[model samples]
Target: MANSPHGGILKDLYIRDEPLKATLQAEAETLPHVVLTERQLCDLELILNGGFSPLQGFHTQAEYTSVVTTSRLPSGALWTIPIYLDINRAHLDTLGAVPGSRLTLRDPRDDQPLAIITISDIYTVDRTQEALQVYGTTDEAHPAVHYLRHNTRDTLVGGDVQAVNAPQHYDYVAIRRSPNEVRQLFKKLNWTRVVAFQTRNPMHRAHRELTVRAARMRHANVLIQPVVGLTKPGDIDHFTRVRVYQAIMPKYPNGMAQLSLLPLAMRMGGPREAVWHAIIRKNFGATHFIVGRDHAGPGSNSQGVDFYGPYEAQDLVLKYRDELDIEVVPFQMLTYLPDTDEYQPINEVAEGVKTLNISGTELRRRLKTGAPIPEWFSYPEVVRILREANPPRDHQGFTVFLTGLHASGKESIARALQVALNQEGGRSVSLLLGETIRQELSSELGYTKRERDINVARIGFVAAELTRSGAACIAAPIAPYNEARQQVRKQVARAGGFYLVHVATPLEACIKNDRAGVYARAIAGDIKGFTGIDDVYEAPSNADLVADVTKTSISQIVHEIILLLERDGYIGDR
Candidate 1:
């Protein structure tokens, strides 16, 4: 039989009765609706399914403090991550939210009612304390820390949640198992000794070999469980990773392995996260778990230093092995031995053997250029899926964002490029010029810093959407701030490509070319915040494409851009 659930019993919080569910759904409409964030939705799914056993809802202040400081619940049960519900201060008055009031949590994607929570405690969030104690960092360089610092609300509302329904999933329904379902499946398969492998990335041959080795050492079946929920910022989307996982499943020894999807929103918390994962897998009926080097690590800091020591996660998981109730199978790094045409654990390899390995960065570079991924490293089928999802840079959708002072010929250049791309078109072309965007997409936005940031963010959202549909978007906005532009780049790059073009035409040249009298008006104080005069324009120090309109003709600049696109495989050579 599978191991007992964490805290000794599985807690199913969902209201499974059809009549009760209908009543709850109807009651939800009358209550104040709280739209759940992506992370909150992930937490709700786990809570309702008993994966997060012993926790019936988001943590109260005392529980959160205990978990953050002690890595345990108030009852002293091992629980490394603190799950909380945050709400904007503005919403408190709007909804009359207060202690003793019940509110409905709705899915942001479709506004579907998922759960109801009766507020027990509403208090200010100690984000700095949470960041330092939990993440071991006050630095914003950490992704989760960054999110905690900015995205989260000022106040946290703690309550007991009553589940109405699970957050709906349209894909991978068969393998997206709840904890109880997985435990039953283990029983059906007679898999008493199962070792779960946790990953947020796509698996390759080395990973396959490593997991198989881990299972063999423990005399267990393998559970290829990959997280389908939110991961680190730049990781591949769950859809593509799921496809890769599906392709890799057949490569596993028949009847010795099974595939399941874990809806875990990983915090990349290194050691604590490793322990957390082991407990979760144990609850899912696994007898053992594979905790490799740097397990759940969040790479490096801004100083190019690793955030956690190598083997840190392994050591921490091993420290709590008995209490965790799941056996820990530690793994060393693996490399491909070219001579043997096989993968071997790096530590076990002989002193003088030829070995090859590809870094994740190198693999991404190869994929971008359509470089061959050898079979020894990864199966061709997996490679094919990755390539299909990420196509060659030339064929993929992209946005060329032009940022500079007003009257710097950005609009002209954007129009010219749009026309040029249209003439050589394979994908749809779009032009989002300054005046046009202000009129159509951001009319109510103003020139203040916050409004400008919002405006640029809106553009980024639109560009990402367009890029996902494989369009070539040309945007010419006087986006003065570097941080806003960087945010846009990060946002759009996840969907397709984003090229930042710095139109480095000087202020004098812009003044001379002011056909719209914008510069003259600013000089006369008629324009309150005209860029290059009253307002500041922080030039990009690291743009993908930089051109000076004064030095190069429009045709030559357009040709240069085309050449760049061709060289990068974003377009065909003409």
Candidate 2:
């Protein structure tokens, strides 16, 4: 039989009464509204659906402090991380949100009301202390720490949440199971002794071997519960990972394993996260959980040191073994033994035996370069899904972004690069010049810092679309702000390669080379907010290539950029 929920009962907060939901929906219109971020939305869905069992809503100040300090709720239940409803002071004042007031929480993707929170406490938290206590570090390199410092607001609004509706998910609806639903499925399948495996990455041959071995060792069935919500910031997107999971499902032994999606926003808290995962699995009817080395670990910190020891998660899970109500099935690193055509734990492998394994970094490199991935590492179906998602660089799209001061020869270089790419003829080429984008996409915008950032973002959006469609995009925008440029880089990089080029034309040279009198007019105070005169232009310090028109010909600079693309396998050598 399945273990009882964390606090002995699963709290399904979704209001199934249609009339009450309609009443709440109507009442929500008159109340102040709070739009949830992507992470918050994921958290809310789990909270409402009993995936985060025993929790009724976002944490109050007391609960937050208790969890942060001692890894326990105020009720003394084992809770590892804090779940907060963060709001800025401006929003709070605008909403007039005080204790006893009700606020509707709407989805940010669409302004659909999903839940209502009756405010119980509005307070601030010591984020630094929370970071140290929960994540063990304040390093910005940690994705959760970075999000806590930059993305999250300081003030937290705590209350009991009433769900108007579950967050609508259109993808993989069949596999998106709530805690109760999974528990019911396990009951129907007669899977009493179930071992759960939590993963955020795509499963491979080793993962299959590990889970199968774990199930056999425990005499249990297996549940592959993968996080479909916000994982570590550069981790594979959930869509691709889910498809890979789907492809690899048949590889599991018949009646031995099942796959389910968990909408979890992982904190990457390492040991604490592992414990939390075990508790969540227990709620989902798993009597046992497979805790691998560095389970839920977020690689390394800023100094290139691991955040936690290899066995820290396993040790912590074992420490709370009695209280968690789930058995920890610990496993070491599994490597393929070519001699026996099977996998064995690294510690158990014989000395001088030939072993082969592919690291995640190496797998990604192989995918990027169209190198062969062996059947020993992954199934063909799984490899096909991954390859389809990540095509080789030569077949993928890319963006070349050139930014500089006014009249800095960026447009000239962009046009030349576009023509060169078009002549090469593998993929369509797009040229997005700043003036053209200003006239077309951002006509209503001005030259203020905010407007300029929006303009650059608009160019980035179009370029990102072009890149996603397997085209070469050359964007010449005076993307003066480094932050905006970096944002564009991230946006385009998600689709394909993003190469930033700094057209480092000297300001004096720009003034001399001006075909129009805009630079002179700006200097003479005739043109207001003109770049290089009244407005600042923040140059990119991390550009992939730096070109100066004063020292090199346009053809030579274009050739150099092509060479960069060729070096990265985005283009074949001419």
Candidate 2 lDDT, 50-78, residue by residue in tens:
76777899999999988999999999999
State model 1's lDDT: 0.88
- For candidate 1, the C-alpha RMSD (Å) to the true structure equals 3.6
lDDT tens digits, residue span 520-548, model 1: 98899998987789888999998987889
| Candidate 1 clash pair list | 394-569, 394-570
Off by over 4 Å in 2: 1-8, 405-408, 480-483, 504-529, 532-543, 548-550
Off by over 4 Å in 1: 1-8, 403-412, 419-428, 432-462, 477-490, 500-551, 563-574
Q: What's the count of clashing pairs in each model shown?
A: 2, 0
lDDT of 2 at 261: 95
- Name the best candidate (by lDDT): 2
TM-score of each: 0.87, 0.93
Root-mean-square deviation of candidate 2: 2.5
